[model samples]
Every structure is written in C-alpha cells, then in structure tokens.
Target: MRIGITYTILRREELEIKERAGDFGEVFMLHEDDMVFPSNLDLDVVIIRNVGHFKALYLARLFESEGIPVVNPFTVMLEAGDKLLATLRLKDRVPVPDWRAGVSEKASEKAVEELGYPVVLKPVFGSWGRLLAKVNDRDALEAVLEHRKWLRNPLYGIHYVQKFVEKPGRDIRSYVIGGEFVTAIYRYSEHWITNTARGGKAEPCYDEEVRELSLRAWEAFGEGALAIDIFEGSEGLLVNEVNPNMEFKNAARVTGVDIAKKLVEYALEVAKA
Candidate 1:
C-alpha cells in the first residue's frame, strides 16, 4: 500500500504523519505547487491535510477519479469548505448557531436586526479566524460590510452572519477520525474567537457531552477525519464549525494523543478495504 499526504508547507502534524507513515506503507508528501494532474501516479490512499487549497482539492479529485481513496474526499471538502453550505447541511440535524447568507447591504442589516447585536460576520470560505468580525452595532456592521465590498474574492461580498453565542471565553475543539470520537481540547482565550492560531491555549476536555455532540456533528458530514468546533451554550453545546482539514497539533499536545498515528492507521485500514 502507498499513502500520499498533500500539503503546501510542512507543519508539525504533517511532519509527524510523514515520519510515522513508513510503518504503514510508502508515504509520499505531495506539495500543492508541485502537483500536476492527468499524470500517472501510484498510491493506495491520499490524505488531504491542506485545507482551503485549490490545488490540493484538484489533486484529490484527480486521485479520486483514478479510484484511489482520498481521506476527506473532494466531495466532503466541497461541503465542508464552504461555511454556508456546511451550516445548511448541519442546521437541520445538529445544533449550529443561527446564521444567514446574503450578498447585499440590506441583507446584512436584516440579519443583524434578526440575530441581534454582536453577530459574527465571516467569509464563506475561511479558517483560523481570519477576516471574522463581530458587529456590535449598525455602524460597525456597515463599516465591515463596506470594507468587504472591495475584497478581490467575490466570496467576501456574500455576508455570512451568525448569532454569537455568549460563552465562558472558550470553545471545544473535538477530533473525529474514521467516524469515531478520538479526543478533544478546550481552546481558552479572553477573546470571542478561541482558535489556537489566535493564541488560544489548549486544555484537555473530558466531557462526555462534548464527545457525544462532536460525534453527532460529524455524522452530519458523513465519514472522514473532521474537527468539530463547539461552544458551551446556555442550552447545550452548539457546533460553531466543522473542519475537514482540521489542525490537531495543539489538540495533540494538550490531550497527549498521537493524532497523526491514528490518521495513518485509518488510512491503512481504508487502503486494505
């Protein structure tokens, strides 16, 4: 069996997966810039680690066309990569924050009024808390929406607004591999966005509710490796977002779980099947 790990830059998780993949099969690190489609390649499975990369998705699609199994398959990437689509798919089955997708200034104003103050305005395609704004008032909402109008990417023009859930300054990051709950960590920070990239500290969370809710959220996305971000709402856990290419370096460090090893194991199992 042969395994391919797609990435742009080598991160800690990718590095660990590459180093350990030898135990499973011949591992190839395919960089996005170096990928050439419609070319011959030999691989039993390909794991897409680089999220939000067009080239990576193309490569995954190419490999998938050849009947090579790609983890977090292109179909899953298409559904999980877009915030609005993921929300729409999961809103009916899972507890996601109330959100509205609109492209006009009037729509933004309507969403704000309906969802209330301090709504989170996010780009449809984004991660790591980049370009996410909390509109506390109409003036701020207008300013943010106006600035987004000039964005070169049309995705920014479509406002993705969500009602911000008041939490205890933290959120849960749960890792689900092969449709199984693996581990979770609490991303603690003073700011509303508790992403590990935003300097949030990772702490191990032993809550069964977190595991249950995370699994239910993953069920909405079907099979593949996923990271579900959940918030501790007044009613219960509300899923903030579901990531197809979820970064697990901080979660691994805090939970003492060899996430890369688990992923490689799952890849080998898929290849054998």
Candidate 2:
C-alpha cells in the first residue's frame, strides 16, 4: 500500500515511524525536506503526525478534503488538540487530571477558592511542554488570565485549570496504537514538565498495570488509537493528556516494541475496513 506520512518537525519518533513503514512498502516521508511526490501519485493512506502546530492542522485538512484516508481524521486531531475538551470528555473514566474547562471569572474564583492554590494553567491546545504554566496564587492566576484574555490567547481562557499533583515532578507517556500499549516510558524531570522537547529523559517502564491503564485510555477515546499520558504517584494514576496522532520513539525502545511493524499493521487493518 502507498502511505504518505507527514512530519512537521523531524523529531526522532517521526523519523523512526517513517523508517518502520519502509518494510511495508512505499512509506513516503512527506516533509519540506525536499520531499517530492509524483504529480498524480495515488496514496492509499495518509498519516498525519501531530506536531502540535497550526501547519499540521492546515495540511491535515487539505488531505481530508482530498478524500484520502487520513488516519485519526481532522476532527480527531482537533478534538485531541484541545486539552480542555479532552479533559471534559475523559473525566471520571480514567482518573482525568482534576480539571475544569471554560471557566467564567466567577467560576474560576470559586474553583480556585475550593480547589486551593497552585493549580496548573495550560493552553487548550499545546504539546511537549510549550506554554504550560503553574499559578500558585489568585493574583498570579488572574494576572495571567487577564493578559491572555487581552491577547485573545485561549491558553488561559477557555482552557484547563487542573489541580496540581505533586509527583516529585515526573510523568509517564504511554504509547498506544491498535487497541494496545506499544510501550510505556517514564519521563523524569526535576522541572515541572517532562516533555522530550524540553530536555526530559525517557526511561523504560514494563509494569503491566501501567500498560492496562494505557489501553483503557485509548479505548476511552471510542475509536482509533491514542497515546495516553499519566501522572503517577503514591495516590496512583491520573490521566494527563491524550494525543490521537502520537509520536513514539522513546516508547518503542523502552518497551521493546517494534513500533514500525505494529504501526504498519494498524494502518493496514484500518485500510482494510
């Protein structure tokens, strides 16, 4: 099958996914890296790798409108793109991070009054530790929200305000595809966030319990696979975020899964239907 995979940034995960699909035949790595396709080439499947950027969003639309079978669809991408929306949909099902979305000024004050200080402030749509902040006091939270409101950035407004879970500052990235967890990796960081893009180290986690939570997260999405992140601690697991078109390389080696093979099989299965 002819498959076209888009890469917004040449992260190691994107590169490896391209290489893994090589065994499946005609795995085109679509990039501005001078990638060229035949003018009339017919791609059976187009995989949109979410780079958590507007460009990927635009290009994904282009392919979807062209009637190409886009994995995870544009709607799925957009749904998973917004943390606030995902959080609302996933609450109580997966121990979703104690989050409140689209809060009014009065509501924010009330929630903060009840939930206490030191909640997390995140842009509704963000990835890899970019533009995520923690607010420790009402003054700081209100100031940040005011600035973001004036700037019309939905990062603070129309976003998620989550209760902070003290984890010694580490999180887990559970890579899922095809209704199973390909692997689990602990992203350790002294800093608050453990995004690989932000200098976090990835470590292997083979705990079957973690793997089960990971699959449950994907299943919770209803259809299509997703990468489920978790903030784990003595209290147990709290769902961090869900990425429909997830990046997976640190996870592949850590869990010892041949990610390429597994992903190709998933694509073929999806295409068959």
Candidate 3:
C-alpha cells in the first residue's frame, strides 16, 4: 500500500511518522508548497498533518474525489476546523462551553452581557489558542471588538464568544484514536489558556472522568483521531474544544505512546476496509 503524509511545516510528529511508517507500507511526504492537482492520484491512503492550511484541505478533497482514502476525512475537517460549527454540532451531545456567535460589535457585547464578564473571544477558524481574548468588562469587550472591526479579514467580524469557566489553572488534553481513548496529559499554566503551544508544561494524567468525556466528545464528531481539551469546572469535566489536526509531540513525551504509529495503523485499517 502506498501511504502519503501531507505537511506544510515539518514538525517532530511528522518526522516521527515518516520514520516509523516504513514498517507499515511505502511512505511519501507530500509538501504543501509543491502540491498540485496530479494527473494520476496514486496513494492508497493519505494522513493530513497540515492543520491550518487551506491547500491541504484542497488536496485532501481532490484525493477523495479520486476514491483515495484521506485520514480524518475532509468532511470531519470542515466540521472540526471551525469553532462555531463544532460547537453547534456538539451541542446537547456533549458538555461544550456555553457560546454565542455574532457579526457585529453590538451583538458580541450583548452576548457578553448574557454570558457575564470575562468572556473568551475567539476567531471562527484558528487553532493553538491564537487570537483568543478574554474580555473582563464591557469596556474591554468594546475595545477588543473595535480593534477587530478594522481588520481586513472578514473572519474577525464574526465573533465567537464563550463563557469563561473558572478552573485551577490547568486543563486536560486527552488523545482519542479511532473512537478509543489513547492517553492524556495535564497542561499547567499560570494563565487561563493552557495550550502547550503557549509554553504550558505537560504532565501525564489518569482521570476516569477525563477518559469518559474524551471518548464521548470523539463520538460526537463521529470517527477520526481527536484531541479533546477538557476544563475542570465546578461540576465536572467540561468539553472545552475538539482539535482535528491535533498536535501530540508533548503528549507522546509525557505518556510514552507512539501516537503516530497508532494513527498509521488506523489509516491502513480504514484503507483495507
């Protein structure tokens, strides 16, 4: 079987996948910069690693059009890649953070008023906690919204506001592969945002609630490898966010699991079926 791994910027996870994939089948590295509509799509399966690149999605859809199996199918990517869509899809199925979407500053402020102070404002399409803001008061909310209004990208106009849950300065990052819990890590930070990309430290976690919630969240998205971020609320674990293009290098180091290998094995299984 011919397997292809698509990436924009090479990372440790991609490098590790390339190294370990030789044992399963022939591995090809698909660079995003050089991707073109090939005359003949030859790969049996493709694992998309470029999380935020539109080109990767285009290629994945092209491959799917030719009957090639793309891991974490473009359909899943479309749903999971957008914060508003994911929240709407998982509503009532999982305990997602209370959120409201708006296109104007007045609507955003109204959402803040309804949700209360210190709401989290996030871009509709982004990852790694980039462009996330916490509005502590009406003035701060207005200021942030005013700044966003001038940005050229119309995406900034679409405000995705959520109620900020009080936590113990930590969150759980759980890995789920093929609808099963693989492993988890505790990301600790002084700030509310505990993403590892922002210098948060990772430690192995063994919480049953986290495991159960992670699996439930994965099932809410149907099938695929997912990284479910859970926040420790007063009641229990709340599903914070679901990442389709999940980064697991830190999770792997803390848990000692070969995540890439498991992903490749799952992809091959899907291809065979």
User: Total clashes, candidate 2?
Assistant: 0
lDDT of 2 at 165: 79
Q: Give candidate 3 regions above 4 Å deviation.
A: none
Clashes of each: 0, 0, 0
Displacement of the residue 226 alpha carbon in candidate 1, Å: 0.4
Residue 231 of model 2: what lDDT?
Answer: 87
Q: For each candidate in the order shown, give its overall lDDT on alpha carbons.
A: 0.85, 0.73, 0.85
Q: How far is candidate 2 from the true structure (C-alpha RMSD, Å)?
A: 2.9
Better of 2 and 3 by lDDT: 3
C-alpha lDDT of residue 92 in model 1: 82
* Candidate 1 ranges with C-alpha deviation above 4 Å: none
Give the per-residue Cα lDDT of candidate 3 at 40.
Answer: 74
lDDT of 3: 0.85
Order the candidate numbers by lDDT, best to worst. Answer: 1, 3, 2
Decreasing TM-score order of the candidates: 3, 1, 2
lDDT of 1 by residue, 48-164 (tens): 877555655666688888888888788777777778888887898788888887788798789789889979998887789999998899889889988888776777878789998
Error of 2 at 145 (Å): 1.3
